[model samples]
Target: MKRFKHLLPVLLLLMSLTAAIISCKKGGDDPTPTPTPAQPVTTITSISPATAPVGSTIAIGGTNFGTSPTSNTVTIGGVVATIVSVTDTQIVVVVPTGAANGPVSVTAGGQTAQSQSTFTVYVAPLKPVVEISGTTFANQNWTRDKIYLLKGLVYIPADFTLTIEAGTVIKGAAPDQDPDKKNMAGTLIIERRAKIIAQGTASQPIVFTSAKAAGQRAYGDWGGLVLIGKAAMNTTSTAALPGGVRGTVERYAEFNDNSGTLRYVRIEYAGAAQPTGSATRLSGLSLYGVGNSTVIDHVQVSYSGSDSFAWFGGTANLKNLVAYRSFDDDWSADWGYVGNVQFGVAVRDPDVADQSGSNGLELENYDPTATTDVTPVVLANGLQQTAPVFANLSSFGFGTTPTTNKSAKGTGAYLAGLYLRRNAAVAVYNSLLYGYPEGVSLGATGATPGVTNNTIDLQGIVLANVLTPVVGNGVLTSDLTTTYFTTSGRANQIVQSSDLTALRLNNFNATTPGFLPQSGSSLLTGAVTGGKLANSFFTPTTFRGAFGTDDWTTGWTNFFPQNTDYDR
Candidate 1:
């Protein structure tokens, strides 16, 4: 039994070894089974915003998009979309132009998948733009099919003409804030003997504005327009033309020179866009030696960073002029301007003013820096003092509450409705001045003969909500009230009333302003009877203000330009 037991242990160990060899066998008869390859899982689960305009970005959620953006190719509506970013499960892309309604597809790695839903693409309505720069040496015509973009200063040389069609839009390029870009602010200068025939209708007035996105436009976005001509100018002293344009006496200017016509035009953000960084200051519209043959009517200048309208030594006449939200003076006439203007309105902003004083009308004749005093006729230039005439003007200043002068100014000049200085020999009739520190200012610039010698006459002047009816330096209030304002023939009154009661304007909102006078308003009556209305230059009407029932600013004027999406 002992011998058999010993043999059984050896036989058990041998059987175990044989079984291990059999279990670990890797021979050809039992070769390893071939491994199966895994299938790719590239897919597009969902696409956000089934429909979008071209250039709009959208996101797509899926599986196996891969981490590398270069390996992913996304297409919307069969158009290849630019992949903005990519992740393993989501991809963001910008819709491509000319894309149509089709499935959103994404090809990742070696596999491609598409979203179940289709993506619709639409075209956004946009205005086509044309850029213009430098000088205009030849006659040019601007049409309405496209918007013209003015880049930097544009000059019209002598003998050239620029014809702007009705409903045409001219936009100034964005101010190149970089100091390296000098004189890059958009400006138009019509040199002497040059002409600009921009005659628009009331239904489709031409528009000049800033080329900026909506809500980003402001005063001084670009430079303004200037017109110079060979018109007669009587100046004994230095003249400050619009945008610092100077009047020369190299030759006698003709009185009958035809400058051009500008009617039914709206200028927005057209003024000194202060490029304190590099460029010169600008004005809304500057006329240097412009003659009476030039036609300017129904023109609105809004958001001017400098003077709205300035005429230096010329017999240029204008009617139906509107100055809104100007940062400086509205109407500035200097250096013997002997023209006639009627039906003008100036509305001031409560928040803005100029550093050189803000006034509705700033009239001057001679510069004190040039000469001490002047006679009517001077031998040097055969020049006389300023003697322009104006009627039916409305100047709305600060609110009834006293203004705190939010703006700065040199010369310590105060805010006034009318500023007459430096022997300004002129006349104003049937004018309305409202809401100002001084309704009529005189002698502030050391004037002597104009107010006292009866050269400067003001008749039918209606002042409402004015702090002071007549105020100036070195002038008695009683003398001004009794001599000029309270005469029997003149109908001048200083009353305290609101805009709704005195003018009854339809709308006075800052952005969308309306200056038409309605019924039950004081502006409907009390016009000059026979004094200046009998003149050929004046429109014979009983209305005391610029507007009477007829809304002159209805059709083409855009008061809400701040919210207008011009490029969209």
Candidate 2:
């Protein structure tokens, strides 16, 4: 009985303690407290770009998308988007391509309002913009007669007119075929009568050269002007040519007929030679059968190999030409050429000569046996001479006398600046000649019959030289320069003023002599008038020098510095 009573008292004490604890729990005074409402899921954090570029992934942020995520999906304007990542408060989804550019609303729930915000996608550009990586043309394929330009070079098919803006710079490409043939160069082959108005002013001259040029690049590093004309090609009745069998003729009718005008153009550092000798070498501007309707004026050829300007057989009329520092002949005429050129100047390096190295002009009848009568060419006020200096044989090794030091087949034979051979007839008058082995040679091999009746009349011609003075042959005598060269040995030098008045009909005052009548000048007031010339052709009276007066002192000078030691 005593033990039972003791146990009952103990149970009563424990019950009292339990009852106190239960009261405390009922009064909300428990030790373990509830978390404060989890900060009410209010003020949602920021979403990483509710708007972004197409194909971009965007982040969505909010209070509890769902602790367990019963359903998780994102949509932009009701369009289902891919969910790249998901978190308790954020979801990342990818914007699809072709997605409309507009304010996009992102939603996560159906019933409950999800965190919605406006987003946008950027639109892509349409045109292809050129960058440092190179030119990126937008519409490469143009409709019929449409003109397209990528980079600076204009690519046109047949029967298309490519209108180029004035002062546009067209860079030639590096040689694509036979790199070792020295055929590594680029070219512009204008087909038929496709007009190309590439005319630039003296202030803004159009430049056609290599990308390596700081101001100017090395000469002959690339091919030059290539104009394919519809005037005439090799004879159809020639039996000597491979394709010109007597019965099978390659007529001129097959050439493309695209006529164009190349006025006030300057071609520099062109005419790279191939392994097939200079015959295959590309000229600065190769006008192949260009029509006589085309106009070529105020063109300058600087630092080139082969001929600066070569006319295969085109009736294009050319005037005001300047050929400076050309490795080969400055001007060359071949095949069926019927053009009249006036006020042409040829300046050659003193180190070179005529026989295989020097000649101011070269006229040739390509198909000697062909009966297809080729047209005649007229040249007036054309100057082909330069001052004499020590023969820098090494500089002319590859161009002037490649065969002198090296074997004939080993290197190559250098041609002259001017070589009139192959039974071709040409007329020249009132010009200047300087240091050259032969100022002008009539025949090439044997007694050529072309020069017998041909007229090469000269009135006031000047031949100047430092080392070996000019020695004129044929009807042209060394006494032509007596009026200009006042110096003892230079008494025969022609005056610039005389050349101006005698060549063209421009009023060049004694004060503003242009390139003529300058004090102590080689060419003073002396020239053949238009009526006096065999062909009554008139041109501007800017003294016949390689450079214009402004080019030397003022204007945007494209001075090609002579520092070849450094790799361009």
Q: Top lDDT: which candidate number?
A: 1
* Runs with alpha carbons beyond 4 Å of true place in candidate 1: 1-125, 174-181, 234-249, 273-280, 369-382, 407-414, 444-448, 475-478, 497-507
lDDT of 2 by residue, 1-568 (tens): 9989879989999999999989888988547767877334422356577557666787767755543333665566456677777777776778875565444443334423334455566553433222111222221222212112122223333555545455555555455432233334555555443456676566655556554535457666666666665555444434221110012223454223446667666777776654433356677777766765676777777777667777766556676676666766677777556566665655455443323454566676655443422333322111111100100010111212122222332122334323455545554434555434333444422232333323222233443221223332233333431211234422224323224334322222211223333344434334434433434344433333332233331232233423211111
- Write out the backbone clash pairs for model 1: 220-273, 355-408, 355-409
lDDT of every predicted structure (CA atoms): 0.75, 0.47
Lowest lDDT sum, 10 consecutive residues, model 2, at 386-395
Give candidate 2 misplaced runs (Cα > 4 Å). Answer: 1-155, 176-184, 213-216, 234-250, 253-258, 274-278, 351-355, 368-418, 444-452, 455-459, 466-517, 520-522, 530-537, 540-557, 561-568
lDDT of 1 by residue, 1-568 (tens): 9999879989999999998888787453776789998876988888887778876789999999878779999988888989998899999999986788999999988888988888878655776887887776799999887888887777788899999999888988755832237655777778888899999999888888988877899888888788887665665323333353333433445666677999999888977554343324677887877888999999999888778888877778899998888888889887677788998888877667776678889887756543323564242363656778889888887654546455443322337788877666668888888778777877623434555655677877887767666775544243664466677677887776544366675656776667777778777888776754566878887888677777677777776688665564
For each candidate, give its TM-score against the true structure. Answer: 0.72, 0.52
